[model samples]
Target chain A: MKLSNLLSEKRPAILERWFDVVLETYPADTKNFLQKQNNQFANPVGHTIHQGMESILNGLLSGSDLQEFSTPLDNIIRIRAVQDIAASQAVAFILSLKKLIREELEKSQRMDSFIKELSLLEDKIDTLVLMSFDIYMQCREKIYDLKANETKRLTYRLLQRANLVCEVEEPGPQQND
Target chain B: MAKFSAKPKDLAKIRYTPPKTEWTETPVEFREHMFCHSAKPKDLETVGFPYGRAWSAKDDDWKLPDNWEQIILQGMKDLLGKYRSFQLFMDICVRCGACADKCHFFIGSGDPKNMPVLRAELLRSVYRGNFTLAGKILRKLAGARDLTVGVLKEWWYYFYQCTECRRCSVFCPYGIDTAEITMMGRELMNMIGLQLGWIGGPVAACYMKGNHLGLEPHTIKSSIEFFLDDIETLTGIKIEPSFNRKGAEILFVTPSGDLFANPGTYTAMGYLMLFHELGLDYTWSTYASEGGNFGFFTSNEMAKRLNSKIYAEAKRLGVKWILGGECGHMWRVLSQYMDTWNGPADFMEVPKSPITGTVFDNAKSMKMVHIAEFTADLIKHNKLKLDKSRNDHLNVTFHDSCNTSRGMGLLEEPRYIINNVCNHFHEMPENTIREKTFCCGSGTGLNASENMELRMRGGFPRANAVKYVHERYGVNLLANVCAIDRATLSASMDYWVPGVGVAGVHELVGNALIMKGEKERTQDMRLEPLPEKEGSENV
Candidate 1:
C-alpha cells in the first residue's frame, strides 16, 4: 500500500497525537485549560491549531499540488510566535509530524518498497520546517514593525509642535458613497 | 531588587521582588513589540499636532529638535505650575512599594518596571533630576537620574506598558496615582514626537473625522443600518434609529469600537433592540460618535479637545441629556474629566431613564448616565420582559473594567443587570474583582495585535482568575462594559483561559430580552445557534 493511503487511513490518530504534542509546550497551568476547551469561538487558538493542523495534514498526505501551504502553517506558528517560547521551540512542532509519520509507517511493517517514498516524505517535512522558520521570523519582524509604527505615531504631534517636520494634508472625510 | 532602608516596614511582608534597575545608565531595548506604532506624518499633520513628520522608531536617530531637553523641561514646569495633582504626586512618593504588586503587568511578567511604584518612578526620577534640589545635589543617591536619549527611550517603553488602570492607587498610602504619572510621562513623550500608533492614530482620527477608526458620516449610517437589519432578523422588529436628528430627548454616544468591532457591535445591537422596544426618543450623532477618548491615554489637553465634541453635539442637537453606551474609559473621562474640561453643560438637564423614570442623580453633575445604571434601573422597575433561559447555555463571569471599577465605582449595576439576564453568573477571585480589578491588560490604547505578548502578560492575572472560575464552575462567557475590554479580552481569554469568550454586558442583555412582537428567538446577537435549537443539546 502507498504511504499516502496509509497516512489517510490513520489520519485521525496521527492528527490527535500531533495536537497533544503541540499542546504540551504550553505551561502546565494553561495546558489543561486548552485541552478541555471544546468551543471553537471561545478557544480560538486551540481551534485554529486544530483546524490548521487538520488542513495541513490532509494536504500533506493527499500529495495534492497546492500553493500557499504556508497559510495553514501561519495559523499554527503565529500563536506560538507571540507565546513566551523561544523561536526554535515554536517551530519544533512541525518536526513532530515527521516522527509521528515514521512511527505509523514502521507499525505498518512495510519497510522495503516504501523506503524511497518515506525518504521523499521526510524531505517534504524538512521543507515544511524551513517554511515554519520563515513564518516565525516574519511574525517576530512584524511585531517590531508595529512597535516602530506606534512610536512614530505617538510622537508625530510633538515633532510638529517643535517645528522639526512638515505636515501632510489628509484627504477630506467622505460621507456615505 | 533594591534592598532599602526606605522600604516601608509594613509593606516589607509582600513577597514579590522589587524591580531593581540602574536608573542612570539603563538603556531600553526596543526588541519587544510592546510599544505602540509611530504616528504617520499625515495623521499628525491633519490634526495640527506639532512635529508631524516621517520618523522611524527603529532608527538610532530620533531627529529631535536641538533644544528637545529644554522643551520637555519647560513642558514639565508648565504642567507642574498648572495641575496640583502633578505637583503633589511628583513630590510625595516615599517608595513604600504598596503599589508594586498591585499592578497586573508586574503580577504577570514580574518585570520590575511594570511595578506601579517603579512605573511612576520612571518619570519621578526625571522630575527629581531636573527640578528638585535633592536630585541635583545627590544625583543617584536621591534616586534621580539625568534625562538622556536612552532615558527618554526607557520612558517611552515603560510608560506605554502601563495601562493606566489605577489599580495601584487603591493601595497607595500616599494616595499616589500611577495613571497620573503615566499621563505625565506620555504627555512629555508627545512633546518629543514619541507617540505610539495604537493611541495617536485614534486621537488623530477622532480629531478630524469626529470618530476613531476614522468612520466618515456615510460609514456611520451604513454601520447602523447593518445593525438595524440584524435587529430585524433577531427579534422580527425593524429599528429605524435616527442619525443626527435634532430635538431628540437624548443624544446616544458610544465608543466607535461598538460601531465597528465584534462583540462590541453586539452590545450596540442590544441598545437598538431595547430602545426600539421602549419607543425611547434618542438620536445617534455621527459627529459625537466616539465615547472612548484615545487622547486620554496621550495627554490632558488632547483628551479635553477630543471630549469637547460630546457636549458640543449635545448642545447643537438640542438634546436634554446624553445616554452613554457600554464603555470603560469613556466613563472615566465623562465622570471625572469631561465636566471640568467642558462643563457646566447647564444646557442639558439631568438624565432620567426614559424607560424606568428613575432619575440618575449620581450623573446629574455631568448629565450623562451609564448604560448599566440605566438598564439596572429598568430591571428594577420591571419595565421589560426577559427570558433568562435564553442565556442558559453560557456560564458567565463579569470582568470589571479598570476605569469603571476604580474611576467611577460602578461595581454593582452591571452585575445587577447580568444576574437578572443570565442564570449562571460567577465573580472572579475576590481580590481580582471590583475596585481591585485587574485591567483587561490592553486598555489605554494598547490593544494592537502586534503587542499580544505584552497584553497576554498584562492580562494574565485577570485570565488566571478567569481560569479558576472557568475550571471550577465551567464559566464560558466573560462580560464587561468597556469597548477596549471587548476588543482585548478576546485575545487574553484565547491565550490564558481558552474557551472563555468575551462579550459586552449588553450582548447578554440582548440575548435574554423578549420583545413584545418578536418571532421565537433561535440565536444570540452573534447569530450563533441558540441552546434550544440544538436538538439533543443538554441544558
Candidate 2:
C-alpha cells in the first residue's frame, strides 16, 4: 500500500497514540486533566497540544504545503517554549510522530512495503521540526521583550524618585487640551 | 516522565535561614520571560497615570518629573500622617522572624528578600532614613538606608512579587500587616511612574468601560446572553437576566472576569440558574459591571474611584441592597475599605436573603451580601434542591482565597455550600488553609502570562499542599471563591499538581443545582460529559 493510503486508513490510531506520547512529557498526575478536561478555554494548554497534534497529523498524512502547517506548528511550539522542557525536548514531539507512525504501520504488517513512503513522510516531519524550532525561538524572544519592557515600566517610578528623567508633554494630535 | 529535572530536597521543611549578604547588597536577577508585559502608554495616559516615553525595565534611565525625590518624600509624609496603620507599621518591628517562612515565594524560590519581615523592612529602612530621629543620626547602624535608585529597584521587584495575601499578619505577634506595607509601597511606586501594565491596563479599562476586559454595554449584555444560551442547551432552561433594570429589590455585582472568561462563566451561569429558579428580583448593571478592583492593587484613591461606581449604580437603579459574587479583593474592599471610601450607602437597606429572610448583619454597613453567604443561607434553609451525586466524580478541595479568608472571615460559608453540594470534600493541610491560607501566587495583578516562572514559584506552597491531598485522596477538583483564582490557579495546577482542575465554588454549585424542568443532564457547564452519563454510556 502507498504511504498516503496507509496514513488515511490509520489516522485515528496514529493520532491517539501520538497524543498519548506527547502527554507523556508531563508528569503522570497531570495527564488526566490534559486528556479529560477537553474545553479549549478551561484546559488551554491541554487543548493546544491536543489540537496541535491532530492538525500536525492531518497535515502530515495529506502532505500539505508548509504554509498550511504554520498554525498548528506555532501553537504546539509556543506552549512548549514556556514549559519546563529543554529546547531539544520541546521540539522532540515532532520527531516522535515518526516513531508513532512506524509502530502503527508495523501493527498492520505493512512496514516492509511502506518503507520508502515513510522516509518521505519523515523528511516532511524534519521540515516541521525546523519550523517548530523557529517558532520556539520567537516565543522565547517575545518573553525576553516582555521582561525588559516590564523592568522598564516597573523601574520607571524608581528612576523618577532618583530624579533621572522628567515628563515632557508630547505635542501629538491626541494631546489637545 | 518526571516534570522537574531537580526535585526539591525537602518539600515539607518550614524553617528559614537569613542569608549572610546584606539586603542592600542582594541584587535581583531579572530572568528572561518571567515578567509580565509593560502597560501600553495609551492605556496609562488614558487613566492619567504619569507614564511618559517608551521605556523597558532594562533601561538605564526612567523618565520622571524633575522634582521626583521631593515628590516621593512628600508622598511618604502624606501617607504616614493619613494612615495610622502605616505610621504604626513603620515605627515598630521586633523582627521575631515568625513570618520568615510564611511566604509562598520564599518557600518556593528560597529568596531571603521574599520574607515578609525583610519585604516590609525594605520600605521601613527608607522610613528610618527620612522619618525617624534615630535614622537621621545613626543611618546604616540603625538599619536606615538612603533612598537610592538601587533601593527603589529592589522595592519595585519585591513588592510586585508579593501577592499581598496578608499571610504574614496572622503569624505576626506585633500584628503588622505586610499587605498594608505592600500597598503603601505600590502607591509610592506610582508616585514616580513605575506601574505594572498588567495592573494599569485593567485599571484603565475598568475606569473607562466599567469592566477589565473593556467590554462595552452591548458587549456585556451579549456576553451574558451567550452564557444563557449555553445554560439553555445544557439544562433546557432559558434564564432571563435583567441588566440595568430599575425597581429591582437587589443589585447583583460580580467580577467582570466571570462575564468574560471560562470556569468563571460557568459560575456566572450558576448565579443565573439559581436566581431564575428562585424568581429573585435582581438587576445587573453593565455600567458598574466589574467587582474586582485592580485599582486596589494600585492605590487607595484609584480603588475608591473604581468602587464609587458600584454604589452609584446601585443608587441609580434604586435597588434595596447589593449582592456580590465570588471575588477576593473585591470583598476586602467591600468589607474593609468600601464603606469608608464610598459609603454611607444610607439610601440602601440592610441586605436580607429573600429566600430565608435572614438579615446579613455583617454586611449591614455596606448593604452588600456575598453570594457564598447567600447560597449558604439557602442551603441552610433547604430552599433549593441539590443532587450531590451529580458531583460525586469530583473529590473536591476548597482553596480559601486570601482576602475572603482573612478580610471577611468568610471561611465557613463557602465550605458549608461546598459540603452540601459535593459528596467528597477534602481540606488541604490546615496550615495552608482558612485564615492561614497561601495565595494562588498570581493574585493582586501578578496573574499575567509573562510572569509564569515567578507565579509557579510563588504557587508552589499552595500547590504543594494540594499535591498532598491529590496524592492521598485522588482529589481532582480545586474550588475557590475568587475570579482571579479561577483564572490563574489553572496554570498553577497545570505546572504543579498536573491532573488537578480549578473551579469556582459556584461552578460546582451550578453542577449540583437541580433546575425546575431540565433535560436528563449529560454534561456540566464546560460541556464535559457528566460522570453518570459516561458510566451509562459504558453500560
Candidate 3:
C-alpha cells in the first residue's frame, strides 16, 4: 500500500534502541542464585559465565528509561541457551563446552594464566550466544508467521462452515416454495 | 528563530479533586448521561461477525441488512490507504490504553468504547479480519472479526459520539489522528445510507442550497443588512455593507447562523466595524458566506462539498485572500480538508489582516486565524481605540473551544485580546485547559434537539468546569471565541451548567466598544467605560 510499508518488510525496526531493556530489566535479582547454586561454575566456569553475561549486558542498556518502563520483563535464564546459538552450531557447542572445561580447571586448582584463559573462552561463549539468539529470534518470528497463517486458515474455514450451516439450517423463500 | 509552538506540557498532574465552593451545581453523574458501543461483544447466532448483534437482514431504510463481507473489505482498504498516519495507526496502535482516558466523551460519559482507541477498534478489528491474510484465516485468534448489522449500529453510535475533538491525538505516541479515522468511518456509514436522522437532515439541507441554514440569496442578504443595522445601534457606526465586490481585497466568510441569528450577528458587526475603522477593503459573499460545514456532520463528500464552496467563492470573487469568521467547525474543516482538492491558489495572497497590516503567513496556506488574532493584532499595533474598562464589572472566564484550542494550536491569541480589553481575566484549570481542553458539552454538529442524553454527556465535563469556576472564583461569564461553542453553551446553561452566561470573545470586545458618539456616561448599571478612540485611524 504505502511506500514505507513495503520497505519495512525488508528492513528491521531500530530495535537496538530498546536492547538495553533486556539487561537492566532482565532480573539483576537472579545473580546470587545463578552463582551460588552452580559450582562447576565455581572458579573457572563461573568466571566464564560472568564474563559472557557482562558482555551481553554491555550491549543492551543505552537508550531510554521510558522503554524500560513500558517493558518490565528483564530476567532471562532460558535465553542463555538462546544466546549460545551460532550460524555454525559448532561454535555454540564449543562455547557450551567451556563451562565444563573451566569447572574442571578450577577443581584441579590450576592458577597459571587461569583467569586469562577463562576470559577468552567466556568472550567466545558470549559471541556464540549472541549469534544463536539472532538466529533463534529470526526462526521464532518465522514460526509465528506460520502460526498466524494457520490461524487465518482456520478462521476462514470456520466462516465458510458457519455460512453453509446457516444457509441450510435456516429457510430461504425458494426452499419454502 | 523557529515559529512559536507550545511544546506539550508533561501530563504528570491531573487529580479527581473537586473545587470547594458553595454555589449552584449539578453532580457529574447526572450530566454524564450518554450511552454508546456494545462492550463485551457477542454474536447471537449464525452472524458473520463475532459479537455482532443478531438481526435479520432487511431492506428497510433504517436497519440495513448485513453486508459484512463487503463492509469489512471496504473498511480494511480505506484504513490501509495512502494516508501515512492512517496506515501507521493500523500497525502501531498496540492498544496500549494510554489514550483510553484522553477522550472527553469517554471521561464525560464513562463509556469505555468512547475512549478513542476502543472506538477505533470497532472498525479496526474488522479491517484486520477481512484484509490481512493472517486475519482472514485466523480472525478469532487475532481478535479480528466481520462487520455486521450490530457492528454497523455500534459504529454509527460510537463514531457519532466522537466530536472528533482530537483529545486522543495528543496522547498517541505516533501522533495518529483519530479524527481522521472518525471522518472516514462517518463517510463509510453515509455510503450505506446509515446516518442519524438529525445529521442526515442537515447534510441534505446543505446540499440542496448554498448554505446549511437554507438561507435563500434574498434571505442571506437581508440577514446581513439587519445585522449591519444592529451593529449601527450597538456601536453607532453605520454604512451599508457592499456585496459581491469582485475585486475586493478580502472575502470575509462567516457562518450563516451568525448572520441570521442573535449575538453572532453582533460579532459579525465587530469584524465589519474593525474593517471599517482600519480603512480595509473587505466583502462578504452570500453564496460562499456560510463557513460551518455540515459535510463535517455526516460524510466527507458532504464535508468536501460544503467546503468546496469557499474556494469556489474565492475563485468567483478573484479576491486577494479569505478570512473565516468566529465559527467553530468551520476552521477545523478548513485546516484539515481545504487544501486536499482546492489547493494553494495562484490569485489569492497569503492572509494579511488589512486592519492591523500584520502578515499572517503562519496561518497562510493550510493554517487559519481566529478572529481574536486579527483583533489582538489590531490592538497590539494601536490600530483600534479600545475601552478596557467597559468590561470592568464583568468577571470573565475564557472558554476555549475544542476546535480553536486543540485543533488549531490556538491558546494565547484570545487571552491576548481579552487581557487588553477586559478588567479581570482567568483560566479554567491546568490539565483541563489549552490543548488538553474539554468539549463545550456539545459540538460535532451532534447538538441535536432529540439526542438530549448524548448531548448531556458531551457537555458534562465542560459544565462541571464552569460550575467549578462559578462556585469558587465567582466567575459567571463564559467568554468563548467559537460561535458553535457559544450556541451550545447557551443551550446547556440552565439544563447542564446553571447561572453561566456565554459570550463570544468579540462580544466582550463589543461591550467595551467606544462608539462614534455617546461616552463618559455611567447611565447603565453595567458601568461601561465608553470608547477610548481619539486618534485611532477610522476605516
Candidate 4:
C-alpha cells in the first residue's frame, strides 16, 4: 500500500522540521563526538539507533512485513534506545517526530501524500515504544512530576546536548554471554 | 503472558488479602483526586510553548470549601477545573487502549485497573460526565458517570497510587503522559490539603529556602570541607572545592543535597577531584550551590524562583563559566530554563578545563555540562591517569536515570566513563534499560514509606535485571553516575538483589585511580587495598 494516505499529505515539512529539531537538539558532545571519531553517525551507538529506527519505520513502511532488523516485539521493543544518552523529556523527543511527520508529508504529492503521512506518523509514534521501554528500566526508581522550570531547562539542556548520544540500537538482544 | 501481580508488602507493609478481595474491586474513580485542572487551553499553535500562565501552589488559597468533606470535594473539582492540559488531554483520549500493556507497575502488581489508559479513565470519565459536552448530554446512556463525592474520594486514592513514571506515553498514539495525570492528581490533592507530608514538606522547604534538604550556608560549606577531607583520606588528595572565591574561572553548582548525602556527596567529590586534577579555576556558589531544582516538582514560579537563584549567584560571583552536579532534574532545569531566566548570559564563558583542553564550542556559555560529558572528554583526550586493572572485579553495569539518560540523551558519556574505568561492563536487557529505562521508583520524590509498594513494584523490573546480570555474570557491582539512582537503586539492590553492591561511576573511577597520593592509600591497582572501602559506602 502507498505510504502517503497514512500520513494524509503533511509529511515533508514535518520531516524537515522534525530532523531540524532532532539535529539542533543534537547534544554539543555529539558534534564533538563526530569530530573526535571522524565518523558522522557511523559510531557504535549511531549504528544501533539507526538500526532500531530502520526496523520500526521500515516495518510500518512495508506493511509490517519488513524483516531486515527483525527482533520479536516482546524482546526488544523497536524505538530509539541510544537516545537515553543525553537527558530528554516527553515533549522535545515527541516533538522531533511530529516535526518529522510534517516534513515528510509537506514534500509529498496528492497521489501518495496521504499514505506517506500515515507511514511517517506511525514511524514517529515509535518514540512511545522507545519511551515505554525507557521508563520500564527506570521503573526501579520513583518517578516524580517534573516541576515546571525543570521541564523547561531539562528539555533545553537535553536539546543542547543532543548530539553527544550514540542513537544506535545494535539489532541484537542482550547477548547471553 | 504472565499475570501481572504485586501484593507488595512494600516498606510499611500493609496486610494482604487473597486475590479475590484485592483484585475484585474496580477502583478506577480514585484517578480524579490525584489530578488538577487547567485555567486555559494547551498552546497547540506553538507546541513547545506553554499555553497558559504556569500553575502555582503559592496562590492555592483560591476559595476552597468549608466543612472538611465538602472541602475535599470542592478541591477535587477545582483541580479538574484548573489546568488546561489536564482537561485537554482527558477530553482528547480516544480510549484506543494503546497503552494497556505498557505499565510496569500494572504488570508488576497484577492489577487490571493499573493499566495506564484505564487508570486515566478513572479521572477522564469523571471529567467527561461533569464538564465535557458529550458526557453531560448522554451520561445515563453511556459509561460516562457524574463526578459524585464517592468519585472524588476514589480519585484521591488511585491518583496517589500512580508514581508518575510516564510509561504509558510510550504507547500513546498522541503521546500523552500518564505522569501528567499523576501530577495533576497531586496538584489537586495539595489544594485540598490532603497531602503526603513527605513530598509536601520538602516542596514547602525548597520553595522557601532553595533545596529539598534546606541546607544552610555554613553547613553547606562545612559539608563540602568534610567531603574534601574524606577524599583526602581515601585518595590522599587535599583539594578543597573553593567556595565564593571571587573571579574564579568556573562556578561549580550542585544540589546541596549531594553535599550532605552519601552517594551524592561522593559524586560531588568526584567533580572536585577531577577539577583539581585539571587544575581548573572553579568556585562553589553558596547561594546557587543548590542544583536540585525542587521547583521541578511543583509550579513554574517555584521552579523559576529556585532556578533564578543560580543565575543571580553566578552574576554575584562574576564567574565566566558554570557547571551543574550529577542530579537528574537539576540538569533539566539548568539546561532549559537558565537561558530563559537570564538570556544569553553575556559574561558567562564557555568551559575550558585547563587539565583537558578539549574545546567544547556548543558548551560555550549557553550550555551546561553533564559531569560525565566533561569527564568523558577528559578520558577521551587521555588527560587523566589510568588504571584499567583495578576495576576488573567491579563487573559494572550502568543504571541510567530517566532525566539524565532519556531526558537528555546522555547515554554515551556515562558509558564512556564506565567502559573506560570498569573492565566488565554489561548492558541490561535492551528495551527494559537506557533512555527508555524505568525510573528508580522514587525519582519524582515518591520515596515516602506510604509509597513503598509503588517503589517496590516500580523498582521490581530493575531489580529483576540486576538479578539477571548478577546471577548470570557474577556481576557483583552496579555502577551508575546519577546520585539518586545510586542511592535508591543501592537501597533496592541490597534489599532485593542481595550480595550485589552499587557505586557511583566516579567511585569506581576513583577506586581504580593512580591517586595523587597513591602510596598513602594503596600502591596497587586494586580499588582499595586499604580499609578505606570498608566504610566509605555512601554513594
Best by lDDT: 2
TM-score of chain B of each: 0.94, 0.94, 0.82, 0.80
Give me the displacement of residue B118 in model 3, in angstroms.
Answer: 1.4
List TM-score per model, in order. Answer: 0.75, 0.74, 0.64, 0.63
Q: Across residues B43-103, which tens digit of lDDT does each residue of candidate 1 receive?
A: 6666666776667666788888789899899999999998899999999988876776677
lDDT, candidate 2, B324-413, per-residue tens: 999998899888988889889999999998889999998889899999999999988889888877787889999999999988899999
Output the better candidate (1/4) by DockQ: 1
lDDT tens readout by residue for model 3, B402-498 = 8878877778988888887777777776666788777775677675544444655466566656656777788777887776776566655544345
TM-score of 4: 0.63
Over A1-177, each residue of candidate 2 has an lDDT whose tens digit, in order, gives 578887888888788888887767654334554677654433455676788888888877787899989988886776566654557667877888888788888888979887888888899999999999898787766555644553453334335434687879757777556
Query: Just chain B of model 3: what TM-score?
Result: 0.82
TM-score of chain A of each: 0.87, 0.83, 0.30, 0.41
Instruction: Say which candidate scores most in TM-score.
Output: 1
Q: Scoring each candidate complex against the real one, what DockQ results? A: 0.03, 0.02, 0.01, 0.01
Cα-lDDT of candidate 2: 0.81
Model 3: DockQ against the native?
Answer: 0.01
Q: Count the backbone clashes (under 3 Å) in each candidate.
A: 28, 9, 24, 123
- What are the lDDT scores of the predictions, listed in order? 0.80, 0.81, 0.58, 0.56
Candidate 1's displacement at residue B302, Å, is 1.2
